[model samples]
Each structure stands twice: as structure tokens, then as C-alpha cells.
Target: MKCKDCQFCKYEGAGIAGGYKCKHPNIEESAKKYEQLKRKVINKDYPHIGYQMIKTSLRYCPYRIDREESL
Candidate 1:
């Protein structure tokens, strides 16, 4: 099966654990990259701000927060 076009799979497995893509090359690469990113953050003991920092600091990112409309 093909990966999800939502493309969020790119961020899975830092314990990201969201949508899954059924055994596709793209998903495999994404999981690998995510794990590598997770390790990098751990090695550095976390940073100040941004994706890299937050990635290492927290298990998951806060960017997953949903936007609320004020209408």
C-alpha cells in the first residue's frame, strides 16, 4: 500500500505514533529518519528552541496542537 498523502508519516516514530502508511518505502524512510532525529536530540541533551531542540527535549512535538477558529 501507498503512504498517506497527508505526509505526516515523515514525523512518525520518535514515538510520534500517528497515522500509519502500509509497508511503503516512503514510510520506512520516514521511520528511519524520525528515529535518527530522536537519537540526535538525545545525544545533544536537548536544545533551546525549534524542532531539533523540542525533538530532543520532549518525546513528542507540541506542533501537533490543533488550531481553533474564533468565529
Candidate 2:
């Protein structure tokens, strides 16, 4: 799939791979806020931050040509 189709994609340089990288937040990092929130979750034993974050990150990519244009 093209960067435009992926939520984690960002338009930085030019061309495909040259200009793109996976920018999904969770892929990039677990921020202080997220870590704190994860600690507070009742089900601390379970892995709860992987899939959802990936999905969300992919869904909101900046370089996605198919992505909805902002007004």
C-alpha cells in the first residue's frame, strides 16, 4: 500500500521509501502520558497498548493520498 493509504505514513522527502517512514505513535514510542495511563489500567497483567495503537496510527497517517483532506 502507498503512504497515502497508511495512517502512520508522513510526507517528508520525495518518492516512496525515500520520503516515508512508519510514524505510528506506538511504533515510535510510549509517551509519559500513555505509560502513566497504562499503569492505571485495572488489567495491568494484559498487553493492552499494541494493536489499538498500531491501528490508530495507521489510520491517521499524514501522507496518505487517500486520507481525508483537512479543511
Candidate 3:
């Protein structure tokens, strides 16, 4: 199932730059880490560190809940 069809999917930003992210409580810790990494990349604080992207398995996610089912 796609993230856009999941109840926990949250959209951040607006327009073409907007993206979907899972907001499930179980993944909160990893989400925090992702944010920290994103900030580091944007600020260029760690020259040795390369840009890291958050990888979420939306296709077969165990935590995924159908939006229609939730409603």
C-alpha cells in the first residue's frame, strides 16, 4: 500500500516540495534521528558526513493503516 493511502501518513511542506512521511508512534525515534541528519546536511556542519535519506518501506509496511479503514 502507498503512504498516501495510510492513516499515519503526514504531508510536510506545500506545493511541489511537499512529501509524505509516516507519523506512527513506533517510528518516532527514527524520525527524530532523520531530522537531526537532515539539519546536519542543510547546515553543512559535518563535511565528512554525506547526505542521509530516510528509508521507509511503505509498500509492505507492518505499521501501515488504511486511511479509509481508520475513518
Best-performing candidate as measured by TM-score: 3
- Give the distance in Å from residue 11's predicted Cα in candidate 3 to where it truly belongs: 1.0
Query: What is the TM-score of each predicted model, taking all chains together?
Result: 0.24, 0.25, 0.32
Candidate 3 local lDDT, 1-71, one digit each (tens): 44445576665655544555456655544434544645532332211111222344432233432332356
Tens-digit lDDT string for candidate 2 (1-71): 44345555544544432434566544323333344534643332121223222334332233332234332
Cα lDDT tens digits for candidate 1, 1-71:
11223233343334434323232324334334545655643342121122221222123222221111122
The local distance difference test score of each candidate is 0.29, 0.37, 0.42
TM-score of model 3 (CA atoms):
0.32
RMSD over all Cα atoms, model 1: 13.4
Clash-forming residue pairs, model 1:
none
Question: For model 2, what is the C-alpha lDDT against the true structure?
Answer: 0.37
- Cα-lDDT of candidate 1: 0.29
Question: Which candidate order results from sorting by lDDT in descending order?
Answer: 3, 2, 1
